[model samples]
Target: MFRNGLEPWHLLVVLAVIILLFGSKKLPEMARGLGKSMRILKAETKAMREDDAPAADGTANSTAAEQDRPAVAPVTPATVTKADEATKTNTTA
Candidate 1:
């Protein structure tokens, strides 16, 4: 039967095991990679939220750099069908 759920010593044991398995140098590299991955994930999620927000409110929420760049048209099913038809006609001809 377990008397206590978790103790400081338990954490120390886990840390010791991790250090032994990964070594000191590898742990720093792993931690750095993890930090980068976390930052990238946070940025992507924020961008997704920003993208959804503009669509929902029908307002442009863009930077000056974005405004200066030419807008790319989104592909639609109708456009795909038209393109396919054009290709087919060209192939037949």
Candidate 2:
């Protein structure tokens, strides 16, 4: 009969068993990984919710168009090394 559900001592025993199985050193690393995964999941869900919300203009099609656009990285001027400049001059001749 499950009359009384999970007292403090029950949780303590569970914690003790986990510690024995995993040891104390690995627990922190596991907890840190779990925290990071939770944060990434939360961010992704928030982004999805935002994407699902209707725009102020009441246009749902605009969101799809925006997603279709390719992301472009900014272009920077290439730095020319002395060796590259010398090679260029040799090739031009």
Candidate 3:
């Protein structure tokens, strides 16, 4: 479904015009240029896909590496409870 609504008659008229304007000798060169343009666009899109792919894996490692960089640990619930009990017993109100 081309959906552009073009039909066989349109193709024949276009072919006839191309034949008259550019002639047979230049048709091969035009076709080759079209092929090269498609290849370049495909390659560029592929490279973008590859570049985006690594970030998904890299994000995990990057965050893990950050965790190792400082005195970043926070006291847990059990430790806080123990500390509170010790403080209360020692205070002896």
CA deviation > 4 Å runs, candidate 1: 55-93
Which pairs of residues collide in candidate 2?
none
Residue 50 alpha-carbon offset, candidate 3, angstroms:
0.8
lDDT of 3 by residue, 1-93 (tens): 779789899999999999999989999999999999999999999977775564654563344456688876887776345887989989996
> lDDT by residue for model 1 over 18-86, one digit each (tens)?
999999999999999999999999999998787656545566677557879997999776534588899
In model 1, pairs of residues that clash are none
lDDT of each candidate versus the true structure: 0.86, 0.91, 0.81
| lDDT for each residue of candidate 2 in 1-93, tens digit (9 for 90 to 100) | 678888899999999999999999999999999999999999999988988888888766457778899999999999767988899999999
Between candidates 1 and 3, name the one with more favorable lDDT. Answer: 1
The CA lDDT at 88 in model 3 is 92
- Candidate achieving the largest TM-score: 2
